[model samples]
Target: MVVSCGLLTANKERVPLKGIEVEVEVKDHVAVVVYTQHYENKEDKAIEAVFVFPLPGDAAVCHFSAKIGQTEIVAEVKEKQEAREEYDDALSSGQQAFLLEESDQSPDIFSLNVGSLPPGESASIRLEYVTELAVEADSGLRFCLPVVLNPRYQPQGSEGHGVKVTAVPASLVPYSLSFSARVSSPREVLKVDSKCSLEPLQYLNKEKTQAVVKLAAGHKFDRDIELFIYYKNAHQPAAVVEAGKAFATPGTIIGDPVMMLSVYPEFSQEVMSSITTSGEFVFLLDRSGSMDGARISSARDTLLLLLKSLPVGCYFNIYSFGSSFEPIFQNSIEYNETTLEKAQKKVEEMRADMGGTEILKPLNHIYSQPCIPGQPRQSAEGTDGHVTVTYTLAGHSFHDKLSFPLQPTEDTGLTVHRLGARTLIRCLETEKGEEVKKKVVEVSVQSGVSSSFTSFIAVNKTSREAIHGPLLQRRIPGVWSRSCYSLSQQAVVPMMLSHSMAKASRMQSHGMARACSMQSHAMAPAAMLQGNTLGVKAKPESLSVMDKVKHLFRPESKCSDDPVPTPAILKHPDSLLQLVSLQKASGCWELNPALAAALNKTSKELEQPKPPKVNGNVWATVLALVWLHAFKLDAQIEWKLLAQKAVSWLTAQNAPSMTECIMAGNTLLGSNVQKDALGL
Candidate 1:
């Protein structure tokens, strides 16, 4: 649970939002949260207060209501425009109304309107939402309550104004928050951890299947609250059946029981051992002004790590966008020593100098390029707000469906069904045609989940006596945490996006057409620009595709055997970066002085302990794997794919004395990493 600043009037007057009480229930992987906000108006006139906040992007908001004295009015879903009109009419008629709507641009943002609160009147607003928890790298279920409201940056001439927030220091916030959570699972609850202070967990039974925890008293409305819940045998399959509303209309989803099934499939060791060595990896980086401080720095570091980890013989390119876009190369170039060095240099020099976040043109440009035959396309996006990794298999599209074969409970709530309906509606949002939109609206209304076309509205109709007064409107400001940049990077997994191409014939036949259709979208003519939007002159000497291809394929007159020069920017690289930089494109590290330096050992010492029959490359690779497992387990998510590549390369070698090599490597590094841990 999380809470932040409350309501404010148009004149910057505080609306005396007393406190917030939040209760969370976690059953398996899904969480149901209810927030109750208490607002009191001490002003002489009636006022309307609007509060904007953030929620999990995929959350399903199923219930909203207002309690004023003895009356409780539950909200009903209606069309967005109709709800707005009804609320406005209620306010004009001197009746209290409440409206809650999702933001059009970002699914995570929401605005709640409390209309016509008379002088000396108090109101309690209840908002309940359900969301599935995300699995972290260590198998912990992550639930975050975001209280930070970083200012959103809108491109110049965009449709609506950006969210304006008046943030103060955490200590200066006026409101208090009370929060508690109940967690239950079929397996034992291993533990619960948070960055915020919390009371000791109380187990309800000896099996440790259920527990309750609460936030410590005197919590300031400040940083986002994050909870990581660990369970024994976290990947075990489970299912839950929830009954629908008792009085719901028959034949509808609300009238039927819904089943939520969770599955964790185990793949064969042979299939899991192999990783793709060929692909077209494109990285799109955001350089907007909002990304100025630690965000850009972290982006640069991440880019360096990725560039160092790319496989040999793959096609790669980088694009940076803001008010304008720039490409490192005219076309995608094959990965090699020269190309990798060039990209690394450019990445190190990149800055957040671009004016605005104009991503459409760059995306269009990327889509217009032809896909290389036999190379599946993958795109990774790095942005301050959201990080996305999209995998595009050439000719085939993959869809996942779940099956439930167990009996459903007879008495339960509709939360599970509502969440499922929200998921379906969002999936259909991008499809064309009025029929699709009609389907989305129908599902939204039936499940009581608000969508782009619908909103939740509650009005008090019992009181006919008009309380005449001026209605002042207020927009509550959300607080922005100072440590947002570091916190975001800490939680981010690596941006590696790769897909295996099981069929080369399919990739050659229909890959380009499928890739084009999937990537390209109809763009507004105004945004289809041939130059920068910030009045910067375009480069006149950009190379054509044919010229780039010719240059890429051209033979060098002379080849040098000298080692690749270490970038001056990384003169004193960290242990992790240094070891990563030494890895070859083929996913193996050469036995050299640089590798020894990265491992904090002398070259002579490394060679002295190597097995007599094994080659240097295998020994070096084994040592690197040992080091990674021993020291960087926390970053397993980011390095997992690369490590898989290394393992595949090692397996292909069929090196002798593998167990002896791993033991010697571990002993040399003073770490006890086993062969099985490195997939030997």
Candidate 2:
């Protein structure tokens, strides 16, 4: 039977969450996050609460603990099976136990089972994890706290992991979140910006290396909380040493000071120019139901931009899929004007009506084809679910590295683990060939980085008396997937697609709904249809269901507040001033003698059309413009007035495509702005 925590309580209202408090501390490059959830059983009968949440894919969880009044229980890591058994035993005996485990499918999704709380009792759960902040394409360090866990599409023959997360409207969450972050680094912290409104950054130290930021009051939890942190001399490699716990014995993992190393590898200009200019690019699009709204539109825009940007002699094709798959062209073809036009037409006509999200089949088909010698193959996958499958595909691909298309608190672990020598050797042998085994082993030994598939567990043997009462289980809901469409119109589909999706959804819900070892509540297609299937809360101005569906597909503005959004660089004072300072009286930010030399080019070569590489003048201009767009900065003058000459000069140059200029800007700034939004 399916039990929903969202099911109305005895008073015909949702259960009230006591509170959610998040604390984050950053030391150098690593961030430790702690999430504490307080829950009270106000009802007369005993209750159990299950929370299905999300974390960054690379986060390394190290601690789990629970507290009841003054009694505290600290958990220990064991093998998956062993941990489950102990949790089940504790639950069956009526003693409170909490189980926190990683989902085998997606690294981001996790299920927390807070079991068997007696009537009027309150429990607080604290889970802590550590993760390295990833530097964005724009050189900013990005930190995100996921408020919604979007549903992931599952492939055929895949065993489901974690509880089936029903998508609920955010208003129904019955909880409020309070969060704060403390940041420290060797380099000076320049600024911090967030998608969510934030309180002003408060400096805690005179050196400007330490700061604190908090979420602004009245946040609605409708979207993910994202923070982009900029630092002075960001690319400079640095290391930080954190002293270990004092209570632990010295000379061990718990006692030794942990050092974090950050490195930014630099490549020579000569090496970049040598790479072949022509290659076969394959575009894989996901048209699954989960990809119903903004996701599909984003993919369409991405494809159009990519199609327009292909080199003169490159080859390309498009493959889109749902439950099954299809190819725009039976084989890879040249990316000429006619072919590009044909592919663009097909992409525009594409829809998210392909049934279910099945990616493996098309991937196998693409792999089955013979590769050309000079024309290296590249696959650009566009999807948001089944990330592990994508990882495995990229891991096995010979020519291409995965490019992420788009897109933590706590601490309890005061200890580190032995590098898991055995697991490292096994992973290296299985993933890489024997050729690099010795080198990998040497590095692992020296670096002391822990291996995958190993876990840390803590156990407390103190026991309490058992009480005889009924055991209840409930599945927690998560945020709807970015690709998800309203399920309220399930009956509108053709019978064949309907049947296929029903089967797929049933299988998916079964795998997702499982809480610990308990049976998961299955959601039938009919029931799902009748429910709020849009995966978001209903808005105040209710529109017809059909209108809601149409709104999902509506094209969104690139940037708000303007009919034609200016490039990001035009809005930032530092970047804008840098561009203004680089501009010549001739109305262009020309790569003159001095500027050409800085770019590894001579003034004569800069004027030459296609001088064995990208044109220096256009690139220089784009770089100036791009620099103007990055990060928040203080601007003392009106940039729009000074920007006219450079913009006009740049616009008058017809030699380089806007696509080319954007790509050049991206190369110079390390920013990954999508093609359609380049605003050139």
Candidate 3:
């Protein structure tokens, strides 16, 4: 601590010289405390109090208590860096707060911490810094290190101090965040052989298509059960429909079902050491009129932050959709230093234009010529979906009203045509510069951070790069992967994509659709008539008619493996999926896998068990009934007997705590079980 005392004091006979101000600073384990004496009167020596941050553990605050003459002061001591900002709204002595990077500031975010003075007179200030620790792996080749918050103290004198952290294997405390789903169950734990349909749903899109999940457990504490809604789609599931509302948008289709769920059985400590990063994603922004103002601004900020965080060589592209969907041509502008600058500038200059949200235009454009356009589709699914989707492109737009409708087909390659009107949206260009498509488009959910892909691509795996978590890959093919930093809840996809896809009808209006289409006209091959096939994967089990659905929304998963659409997608509620009607295509897409297994069985005793009666909840009983009808309930396994037991289990269910067993169970058990158990 340095303190200077000016020597100029009055000698009796002569005029006194000035006494300059001096400051005193205290250094501690996590913080450096300081006080300055400011001259109330220059004649009285000017004493200044200044706290210089010396610790590295990023802390944004400090504490202070002082007595400078009659000035009775009680104020929070702050690091010089933090004290510089204005905050009349801040707390007086406790809870001093400040933004590490102001919203207006182009912040290169690092870590930040804050501290407080001891609550009594003549006491030392207490300070704390946030830091994270994880296990390390030194396999022959260096695995990427996780990016952890380094704890350091920035006390006026102490530089940020590294925290002594021990990595303790941890598990995410299971949390409960659920709404009453109104699910049902059939059968009890030990008795009841009748097939009682237990249903939790009120009315879903008026489809009346319900599931009768069959379930059973090994024992009471034995929750080895898989209770996902397993069913067959006969042919194909319908396209998405705008059945519910989210984010205050009217007639907006949900990116996921109300019953949709994402479950992380347990928060793994592994999340701390490895880079659980999603694959390299290219964000295709919709700067259409509907995405004006707050949406655009938020997107700009979000994208910039994401660009700043991406891994080096992680590819991406930024395209806008308005009157026309176009990329800033490197032919006209390069991807060089100047080009990136111009690209950012171009983004700043962007204003949502009123134009058509053409489905085929952007996909065809980016696919035919990628920005990094070098890679080819990994499989036939990728290639065909791209080609066919590129064909189904339409310039029509829809807004909140009639935003989407079920599509029988898109003009390009082949598509399952199963999703609804509102489910489709634009594609993200990838490292290969091709449009990364999705089987299940990842729409925005209100969790996780957006990727700073632009920045990620610039990063080199230097040792200094924080060993954060594992870099998650493209679980499947899709451009935009999950975001990393938003710390909301579980990691979630961005909501903007689905929101825009649902609003396509806005551009489809007669007034703007034609003109927008004319401005970006390109010949499409929708004119060529070619019969499309579902590109069925035979080696793998065929996708049950309900490939990605469950009895109710349970988070057995989130699909980052789906294909994304090109150009702009037409949004509607139920994305119409086409079932290859055996009569129409002269092809049987598939039969329910379970039923097939049952049918293929040759055991005489196991053949076609008698139909059972219902007993408990509507969902379980109904599901049991359906399974019996479909697979004819095998008798060897005593499916009817099992169905009866399932009904009895539910009938006696006043209050049961099988949730944990169900959640962790690997069998047919469920969290909030709706329907289950047809013995065999």
Candidate 4:
């Protein structure tokens, strides 16, 4: 995906970023992407334009070059400060220059400076990076190209700064985009799917292991472009060995042959059945203003499911932060009916009204809390950061795994080694010794990977045409739009929020008391109360069945006299969410109207088909499993753990007639799920 930031002339006139062309080549699990951004100066003065964009967090930018007329200047890796000095010197000497650097706060963000472009001049920027494709839950290799970058929030007195973005609505963006991909793998390419329009996949080989696809013509730059590529035997392990740079010094990473290994482990049913029931589960949710709309709603729904899925004997706590933080309880509490209900109620009331994104304080508070004896804490958040494991869900399947090793292969260049070096530099930068810093710089320079201490700089020293006047600085504006997925949407908002918060901090720098007041307001509780209560009490009553039916068929009227309608009708909670909500803390479903509604059946119908000796809970649970396998297979990633809990509960009960229950459930639900599918 191309995050193309358009250019603006020094006088604030449009410099017209002509277009963006993206070419992606996928070899097995790794992708090599090349982006060419075209720009032309239409005005009558020399201007220095800046472009800011984001890449995949883990991508390694191995190449950056600029072509002006017939001259192409390739950048070289150097210390960030040295590169800045060189760029400034080149510009001062009336020569064209280019500088690229990674952001301090986030590795994924990058800034490119095109210095001293004479009027009527045109420049084409060529940037290349390499990243590994993520595995989706449905066993598809997922690739995404983002078009929107939301703001990030920065608190006062923060050390690092955020990007300053002048947003342009997607509809108003004036640039064209072209995207295409060539994918080849040892395994057969089952198919490729996307939410955006795409040309039909074309197989390039008789074995169907190589194919090509492209985004359809006239595509708009609104939502992110997501491509899900499925392959037969996707989980099968494979390796690629990339040959090292021939001319580089031997003994260095660049001169060594690198092997990339991909492994997906499968656990036996016995091991899966032995899931740990003990842990201190701490959930940190972001309630920043950027999270308004579908983003907050999605988070609330995911939080509710997690609360319901917690084991009965475990302990858990809920904390939400924006500028401030609030906990559902004073400390972690044992999971039971009362605690689960209270947490669920509080989660349902969560809103994205917490002014800014100041997460440090809440994170510190959580860490300060005394650890429960023998219960390790697992903290889950709704923001971007380090994660040990990830579970992905496609339309109807789930897969999990992230890291892989690099091997030696001809014509692969040093992409794998550069990526590895980048990873190592990041790890060592977190250390506290001069030796660590030295090693990080060494690896960054040797492997040509941009890092916190290094940057990419190039100058047109051989150009005959010279820039004669003082250059005016210009900032390019990128299209800002809403993301299709809530998670991706969250990623877009924080960059802008961070910019605003940083501006606020600068404005308040002169007055300590004012800064303190702003900070106080940011941290002030939205609905904090004494004792165990953290959120407003649950609604005293729910809508009646008649009211629900009316909600479904209700006509829109602007009249204020009509009672405020409920949030949803028969479609509000959705069948999957409704079924998950009815699950007890013990992991079994209770036979009830809500459960029947989720399954699109009557309570009587669900109860009548159960085997004579099977427990009602067992029958209800079996129906839930059948519905999941038959209808909600695409969301298995979300419900997998919870379903496992139900299976374990059933196994402990030694429930009789499980096969009969499964058969009866299949018949009642019009599904053909087998007993083994439900792990009976």
Candidate 5:
């Protein structure tokens, strides 16, 4: 019998014995799928599981299925090498029957064809796989294997999902990244070396369906290597196909939608060039709390690699953010081996401290600077007449953490104390109170969500660039989506703000509305500074449209469902639950582990001997209802009933606070969800 089995680690995350972690995010026309570390554990033990990938194709829907495969090896052990006996034994059992097939699986997800192949001699098979996005330029992109197995077994009791990275042992760090792996092209075998160099040019024979992998033993048992396959780079080809698919839409609709863009002779190339160049000429850095372990180490390593790759005189800068702001070296710098090597040392010493986020301050610092105009700065080891001009571009900022300010860093210990004292210095301003602009990023990886927030202090005087690309583009993308872009933009905001402040004060102190209207596609600070009035100095744009739209047209949001059906609610329960225990485990002094768990449990207990299975979709329903309110879903239902039912269950749990209890209580109505408890 084929029974469901999976590997579970601490915290209940899953690791399928032999499979890849895949993430899927559905969008309007396309799905942004992320494939992660290919599972590389195999001892020839038999495995049978089914995988299904639903590739939304142009002509029609196409399905790719991967199956379990098995192959046996036969080694002759004869001391006496008699030609006649050797020939007989070799002829009798040279070939072992190889079987490969898929077991049951979800219809939407697919597994590639896994083949049963013996070592040395490779066999050809007609196998199909999903074509995924190209993550790297390395030749390992297009991987083909005779057999494909679903990686990370469905998280035991949980739904099938990608392998959770943080759950794996450190030793099993994914050497390669996997994201949105789909196979439109057919090939066989996975490839990548444990160490450095891979086989030379033309390693892949166009005619051969599979390639033989040879490995020399290192730390593991035998001199063997694991095989992994990925889609090779065919960017130009993929673009053509995608374009064709896009064009095939009704000519009228297509024409109307992209008429202006189509007129640009080189729009596609220009767009692609921008994506590539944005980073080619960037200074992605990080200023989060934990810089210990490999956080700072990994970041330094990446910066070194990035700097070393820059073309001569390519511009860059180095700004550090925390409770206080300063530049490692003030201004946007030019690239050179000498400066690169020197900067590498500075980056390595980065550490974590309990400080507020001044993400916007740093970017503003760079924007405000009077550089060597376009002249590149000399190396950090300057022995010349020019004094190194590192500045303390300090600014006062607000933070939620200020309700309980942390002991300042040695560098900023006195500065924060001074600022706190300054707040009370002016009686009129003290009554005004500080305005807090918290920048947030919501990251959803697999089924989990994580959020990071940084405050933009209203005091107006700091500039520090606070984020960076430490991991590979493919790695930590979830974090990137949630936090990266916002932080990057936030970083730029201060630079633009400060530069505008200088420029406007110098020329004409045009008011804030006009300054805020400065518009640009790409955020090049120098370019943005030229016309910074509209965005920062202009009169406020009509808030009327947004106000009217919100009032008149309310569409049901993505997350919430309407009020729960009467059937889903119950009157009483045997015992109520409270995650006070779970809350304590999280190591925070003040927190509510969310009352949903307790309420869900109580709902089950209320059903008593025959408890109802709370529909997982109901969580989605609750989310939808909350979104509906956000989206202004105007459909009417008895809001009171939902609040009461949910609250009844929530109250039974006896939450620590009314806030927590009310938040949980609102779930039954699936309407009016509060802000704090929701996932980013």
Candidate 6:
């Protein structure tokens, strides 16, 4: 029989759980889930049970309770410090007590302390939470119950209050979960989809506005439980109004109806481009250890999406932060193809091995950089420390200007609109002891409607009796993937080779022979050798259509050849050639960890293989300029000759568009660049 199991600790003791049952109810787009965990102690002595788990980042917990046979005890919400004191007191007094709270560091992680359970005793803990269903990329309502909790990297200078998740292989987790969901919406239910096995959805009404689905039997908590609910006309704007609790006093905030509005605004591409035609786009990434696993992967994927969608002629830079901050470029640079290729290569090699998430430093640096005229600066940050970072950014001067251009304005506009609306509400009130703007900002930041700030509390006031026993305090571990943590240890892929007059390897395949035969050696203006490794002599050959296409994109092809120089306004051709030589087959450069340490410098300090501590993407851009300087004036024959092919190849390429590379480089440099520009 499958059983719920806590993380495998260094001690090797496994806390076996009985079962997990979840009941969910939906009203329009909001879903309220009641998670019940059953635990039984088989050990000979009394024990404390701790369970670290993941919930939706925005989940608002409203109820917590523990049941012991005939007696039922409920928990009450109090100030964090006070709640901790109460929980500790009950545990010391040997009374059966339970405590639940969100992690101050990460919204997605939470820990439960089940204290004072005697030997052979069993108890049921139930937690109820409410959250708005997120809209998926396909316009469906996405509901996810996370079973896999990855380790979160704590940033330097952050309070070490983030949950410490113990990881194990997925196959070793012994938890059995049974989940059933009821979905209700104003629109007719169209369908439901899930990665997990699910029973066919059942409609509750003929109108098809409501439906229910259940996980198939014999399921384990191996991965997140995900469900997508599609509705008719999902793209249409919509709103839902929920009445306040009946017990709440009338005319108060709790008594008022909670109104949620959704809007999808569209603007012409031209208008959108005109507003952000050229500007600085800064990306701040958190490579702290906690970002290991799916979090980093998701961040990388989001970075790629944003890079591809950038306007053709914008300047951008990346900063990643852990214990410190590093910027890819000392300042933002213009985007183009060759630079983009290098950036993409660097980004693809990023790992969440950076020590901590000290993000403020990078933010300060990014802000300190002088803004260019007619080019606005937009910063986006991505991290698991949502609350801490959001609170920090909310207080920044640039917070108002930082925004997602591609996202619907209403999403952002509403937050500002609501801030204004709340300001109006305060102005309407007779009380004016507090500064009006300050009060409004506080209300907007600390709204009860925000699950981030407030929590639900239920107390069993009827029970006055206390029990006697020694309550064992246990710290429960979440399910972490062992394989993900070791991703940094994987071997790096090797770079492909391309050079002038290089002898082709024995043609095991016809494709290689064709490629070699098509090289256009006769087009070279001179045979110059920078080094034995750089010079290549070859027979003249006809270039095929494919060969020309390959020649245009491949920088390595022109390594030793010098073509006729043309007047160019762009920097040293040799340095540019060296940078091109560093590109891997994936079109990006990566840090050689060994090389960095051998040079007695931190990876961030090393920056590039050449001069000026600019990281990979920036290194490539600087080298391009170095080459451009040679061709800018025809007076320098040797420099121009060497750089001519390099410059031509560089010009033919489009603007750098690989955001992931910028992100990776920034991360390596300990800089803060947000991923929110893509609304990720």
Best by lDDT: 1
Could you tell me the lDDT of residue 335 within candidate 1? Answer: 88
- Candidate 6, 1-680: lDDT as tens digits: 75535554545555646678999887655677899998887666778788878776546555678888877887665545556677677655556667777665444566777776777888899887766555443456667787776444322343444345555566655566889999887789999899899999999999999999999986655667888889886644454334444565555444444444443222233443233235556666667775565446535543443343344456666666667767667777776665555555565666778786555576567657787775655324542111111111111221111122222222211222222223233222212334643443334233332222223233333333444455454544456643332211111111111212121111101110111111111111111111011112111111111222232233322121223232121011222222333333222334443223322244445553343333444344333333234222221211222233333233344335335534643444344434332111
| lDDT head-to-head 4 vs 6, winner | 4
Candidate 4 versus the native: TM-score?
0.60
lDDT of 1 by residue, 594-643 (tens): 67766766668778999999999999999999999998775565466568
Candidate 3, poorest ten consecutive residues by summed lDDT: 528-537
The runs of at least 3 residues in candidate 3 whose Cα sits more than 4 Å from the true structure, single-residue gaps closed, are 1-179, 182-282, 331-340, 370-680
Query: How do the residues 1-680 of candidate 2 rate in per-residue lDDT, one tens digit apiece?
Result: 84556555333434535678989887655578898988787666666677778776445565678888887787765545556778778777656777777565444567777777777878888887766554543457767777765434332344444355555676656677899999988789999998799999999999999999999986776777878888887755553334455565665444455432344323233442332235666766778775554346435543443354345455667888778988899887876657765776687778778876556687688768886555665324442212111111111221212122211013423322221222222224323344555544443333232223222232334545465676555445555544554332112211001111122221211011110110111111111111112111011111112333343354532232213333332332222222343344333466655444333344444344332345666666655555544431212112322233345456667644667666655665566655543235
Off by over 4 Å in 2: 1-16, 155-162, 241-259, 265-463, 481-680
Q: After superposition, how far is residue 420 of candidate 5 from its true place, in Å?
A: 39
Give the range where candidate 4 is weakest over 10 consecutive residues by summed lDDT: 531-540
Candidate order by decreasing lDDT: 1, 4, 2, 6, 5, 3
Give lDDT tens digits, candidate 3, residues 9-105.
1221111111111111101001111222121222222111111111221112222222323333343323223343422123222322221211111
**341-440 per-residue lDDT for model 5 (tens digits):** 4565565555545254444665565545554543322113432212111211011111111011122223211111111111112111111222321111
- Candidate 4 lDDT score relative to the true structure: 0.66
Worst 10 residues of 2 by lDDT: 510-519
Q: Largest TM-score belongs to which candidate? A: 1
Candidate 5 segments whose C-alpha is farther than 4 A from its true place: 1-134, 138-233, 236-282, 311-315, 333-338, 354-358, 367-680
Report every candidate's CA lDDT.
0.67, 0.51, 0.23, 0.66, 0.26, 0.48
lDDT, residue 57, candidate 2: 46
TM-score of each: 0.61, 0.49, 0.21, 0.60, 0.25, 0.49
User: Which ranking of candidates, highest TM-score first?
Assistant: 1, 4, 2, 6, 5, 3
Q: Give per-residue lDDT, candidate 5, residue 237.
A: 16
